[model samples]
Target: MGVSGGSPTSRFECTRRLSAADSQCIWNAIAEIGARVGDRFTSNVPLFNCFGDHKMAVRGLVSARPWVADDGQEGGGGDGGIMMVAGYPSLREAVIAVAKKELREDRVSREQALQLMKEWLQKSQDIKNGRLDDAFILRFLRVKKFSVPLAQQTILKYLHFRNIYSHYCRQLDYLEPPVYELLKSGYLFALPQRDKLGRRVIFANAGKLDPYKYHNTDMAKAHLVTYETLLEDEDNQVLGFNHVTDLKGVCAAQMTLWSPSELGAIIKLGEQAVPMRHKEIHFLNVPPAFRMVYDFCKTLFSEKMRNRFYLHSSLEELHQSVDPKILPKEYGGTIPMSEMIDMWMKEVSRKRDALLSLDRMESQKVMHSYKPRTTTPKASNGITSLPGSFRRLEVD
Candidate 1:
């Protein structure tokens, strides 16, 4: 029973502190719930008494409720659910390292920068339900180059994106059945190795997408889980990442599956919402048919992003920009695609609690109060521009 942290509101507590048990069963039970070294380990080990609607079990902690609702209520039943607390000392070290890096690059210490940001953010009506933790605020500060006003606006845009697209963005649980299936299916994942520039490589196979089996919302949630997990690494935050999607064998059915608005949503998320440095997006083995969709989507990209966008006819061409050593064997690298996917899955499992805790960010109050832009003007090329403000907004 090597358990420690919990939510302030959680009523469960032991009258006496439980010592770490030197039992293999205890370790195995903890691992089943994807617990990290510092995560609170609570299980039915026959030694600790169960309290607060949770009955003691013989085997291990179970996830009775997979989804945490908008109002912070756990859905489903069984023993009131085993709560997985999220924290690790190494993660704190990583955050410190990132803050130092920002200081080195921008000559502004994180302490000074965040102090200024905190004053403004405290008064700002944006991010009503989100945590403004040091690490979280540092993410925006680093990306915006310590410009408090810019960082604040970016945070607002991110929240607005989530509110406007709550249907797709809400309750993005990695362990959720559909998202988990997509994660294990290798539809999208971060490569085990980084590119030559030290950027993370996000690989996707369009051929693997089963439109009939999974909805657009499921795909959105899966992508969110994968990207959010990748961004947790401080190195990824600084160096950013490359996106490579293999369009080989993609049929008309799969291409047509994403409606124009859905396509706009994807573009908006990558370009405006996420506070990540997206270095490049390479479309490998792209067929002639995809050109139509590509051209249409290009309308949504900012000029800077349009410059970062690339199209590759073969692995040879892709290798010119990205290192071959970072790619999977199918793309002429040493490791197999399955192995890369397995590595990503293990990383996801390790961060399971943190990923699940993202449920708290889904604020119904924000969504209900959000007002979408009614006028979405179309370009002369006949492409309907995405609604609402983005990075390209004309700021006074």
Candidate 2:
């Protein structure tokens, strides 16, 4: 998963002043949590995330209420005192736009494209190892371009369905048939019925149930008669036979059938190994956010630069160096400070070592177990067979 975001931690300092020790404690807590979560899902998948303007939003640093610009412009407030314009789109839209732009440029060769996808798969292996640097990501955004493919669009549709399934219907059991029918043929099945209150009610008959009930209705009246009449006069037929003989064995006096165990043995031996190299890549990319947090902490403690100067300068530099191509309005990172911090902390806690150990245990249960093949033989075609003699191989 290719994650792109701000410097893993808020750029804004806490409003309530903290002593050096307090600051260090908070930083340590953040680091620990980040490390834990990053390790947990590092081998899972790539999550190509892009940062938004509100990257500096952290609890005790920003307000819960949406920030309003001093200029009275709505939706323009952000961390580091940056004010957005009214026309700016949300972060999701921005990321989508960037992805589209990347697709449009067509910079990557077919081979390179495959390689890049492989890298994403590899990055899903471990969070800490898989984490990307902000500068590196910025460079990648500058050079690499992409478009949201049809597969991603399909995924988005599924995600949207999952999000709003409750609002549109009682449960998913009733929704899939109609949705699939609509997607496939543009026409939907409708059951013409009436409620007790005399209100006309229409339910999807996408299950193809009770075709006769729809025969006289307006929906079926147009073509049902023609179809039924045509089917009745159809040339469909069936053949009957008492027994069958195998022509291939006609010359042979006897034949031997393969055992189920033998077939299973052959299949098992022919199976290819599951691709695990990609898991390594995933492991490498997983902990990028935590690494960012760690690096940010290190920057705060640099001996060459005063901590105060480093903090102010780093924030200002990032603010001024925003690339127009990868702008927040085109990608992500616009989460409010408080919400961002809350989400990070929650993710950290949710993916702790204890939870991950349980996950690992569960995964082991579903993994296929390999059993060695035995040389045992069984009777075939009601004939007991010898190990290797020609007399043992017989056909009826």
Q: How does each model score on TM-score?
A: 0.65, 0.17
Q: 1-396, model 2: which lDDT tens digit per residue?
A: 112223223323432355556545543443344344431112122221111222223222222223222333222211111122122222222233433443342225433544554465244332123223222222222222322243222222322322222122122121134332231221221111111111111111122322222211222221121111111210100000011011221211111222334333322321111000000000111122233322433343224222222121232243332222222221123433333223222322332332223112111111234343233223333443323332243323
For model 1, the superposed segments whose C-alpha errors exceed 4 Å read: 1-107, 362-396
Where's the lowest-lDDT run of ten residues in candidate 1? 75-84
lDDT of each: 0.59, 0.25
Deviation in angstroms for 4 in model 1?
33
Per-candidate clash tally: 1, 46
Which digits, one per residue and each the tens of the lDDT, describe model 1 over residues 61-113? 22221222122323111111133222321222333444456434343566787
Candidate 2 residue-wise lDDT at 365: 19
- lDDT of predicted model 2: 0.25
Best by lDDT: 1
